[model samples]
Target: MWVLIFWVLVINFLSAQEKFTVKKIVFIGNEKTKKEVIARELSFGVGSQIDTSDLAYSENRVYGTGLFNRVKIWAERDSGDSSIVYVWVNERWYIWPFPILGWKDRDLKKMFYGAGLIHTNFRGRNEKLIFSFALGYDPWIEAEYLNPWVLGSKNLFYSVEVFYQRVKNRSKILEEEFGSFYERHLSFALTFGKRYGLYKRFWGSIGFKEISTTGEVPYMKTLSPSGRDQMFVFGGGFRYDTRDIPIYPSRGFLVSVGYKFNRLVNCDCFFLQGGLEFQGFKKIGIGLIASRFFILNSFGREIPVYSHFYFGYNERIRGYFNDVFEGENIFGGTVEYRIPFVKQKFFKWNKAPLEEFSILRFGVDLVLFGDFGNTWFNREKVLKLRYLSGCGVGINFILPYDLILSVGFARNDTGRGQFFIDFKGGFE
Candidate 1:
């Protein structure tokens, strides 16, 4: 009996090391996505030789595309030393005509509403096209187009956007002094980007903006003597991303750097700006820990109120959840440990009102998080400035269509905790 057990163990060990050549590859459930798009992410081709364990790597590569909710890859042994590879994927619905109803910080006075049409996988090639219009606190209409793989552009990517908006200035100083008013903005931009392999990209953009203020306020407008200015925008950036999953990555890091120049075409108002960002994720036991840090600064004559950085407006330090911190420069960081409450999977609801909304992928995660940040004042020594920070716990709801919403609580130096709502990890 001992001899029989030893022989069986030896056979199993030998089989695990065997390599097989792929005779063919088969795919299933990729009805909307093109075959080439899926094949481009594969690590092995039809004639490639691979170990059985390598199929898992291929599965992750396809899943990273953000087009599929579920992906599975396997191999079938043949009579010879060759195998048939099978790849199965569940594609997400491509088109959505959805309504938008939201408020800033749940403030009913800051309410805004709109409707939009989105085609994520436009033409089944991972392109995106959006058309939207909104009415309320700040109303706007916009259109955007993105093509990652242009048909005849040497494998380059491009995007175009145009919009017109009535933007109400969110400056507390302006509102406190002169009173609240609206600004007008009409802008158009074009960008071209190139991806090196899978995880790196470099891009450049150029655009024009015509902006005017209803009220002449300090730090609100460029020097055109008309309370309006026409400016040219130029920017370039580089990125390196290797996250296993973009929405809730468990491992990997993302590094990004960008610089921008906003200059009046005919006047003297201009600003030069640059920013650096780093986000990393790692698995610890059954949970994951993630951290993000970013710094942005500008140089030139004067930083407009609309362009200045702030803690409470566009950004936040957990401790000062309801407070605003503004200055010449801004920097901050956050750390989070996320434990899986419910693993993500697809649920079919046959009686749903819309077919695209029928197949749902919902998940819940419990998160422990902390945040710290401050504005950089030129007059004050950088080392002497005190930073604001806070820590708290929350629940993350991963909804369908790659949306994330958080309900959380945090406390700052005042020892008073504040309940808050955030989206997309509030990383940026």
Candidate 2:
């Protein structure tokens, strides 16, 4: 295929380049990110043999940090067997204090709007800090921090989060027959992670969680028989990513697996849940083909209804509204093809601060995608949920703040279609 041919050509080209010892590694055009942080991401340092393929990997790693608008890396041959590797980066605005008005579901009717302050590269060390409050259908106040290196150890990483959320859990089955339930949850967690080489990360976390509901459903009696539901939870996970970019990957593979255990603090309720996700991307000519697969499951005592796996919300599928289905297990797959229509910089400004940092560039991408999924409540009912599928097309606007605004139209197998708007690039 065209993708295979492209890789073959790239391999041949890289093989033809004469490897040289790196005399020095230099960074240019970075205004906020620390040079030491950038150097740590490089595959080759001074006195190391510089391979073109390694340079490409370093470029991808730097770009993946989501700190730069453009990354250019090249090696200039020096005298004898040495060469100078130059890395030039156009830094993005790292701090964003912006208003947030967005759909709680893909549907415009369910709205959650708020304002938040986010620092993507705190202190120029690739650390992230976020504080936000959202209102309307699902309301929450949350704060989180992420650091790839803890205590200056490259292999040690950590993340901490604390949040309080009030959610109205509406069920079509409940609405048509009984009434909806509202949940108030408060939780806090801290996680430690260790890096295994360049691509794999292992992490574990412990947390306290509490759930209180305003109304009871059919499953509530089994969920919190003691009328008090609190839990001490523990979880662990691992991830492997080699994508060209985290926001819009054009190549490479990503896989993650994780599990959680809940031990009730006030009741006998206990359960275990786990998930696995995989994504792959391939460049073929001018387009990138991407695919995703995921599975979610729970075992031990049946999980609380509020803890059940739900799909059709957020990233599950394009044509469905939020939380359309719920079950103990869910599985799905998606395939998409993406291509940029405007690959060139559309314009630029030469104003004061804009002149030095203001390279206003614009680009648009086209996406065609299809998704298929099913959910299950029990072993006997595995795959019993009717297969749901959707197909859609979208226009993505590339903009400052590392944002991708998306406008899309989609139709499901049920012959229902809708128009949706969304943004990409945020911690989940």
Give the alpha-carbon lDDT of every model.
Answer: 0.79, 0.76
60-138 in candidate 1: lDDT tens per residue?
Answer: 6787787886778999987598889999987877787989787654344578899999998987888899999988868
Predicted structure 1, TM vs. truth? 0.86
TM-score list, all predictions:
0.86, 0.86
Return the top candidate by TM-score.
1
- Candidate 2 residue runs with Cα over 4 Å from true position: 1-20, 47-57, 216-222, 319-323, 344-347, 352-357, 383-385, 408-411, 414-420, 424-428
lDDT of 1: 0.79
Clashing pairs in 1: none
* Model 1, C-alpha of 219: deviation from truth (Å): 7.3
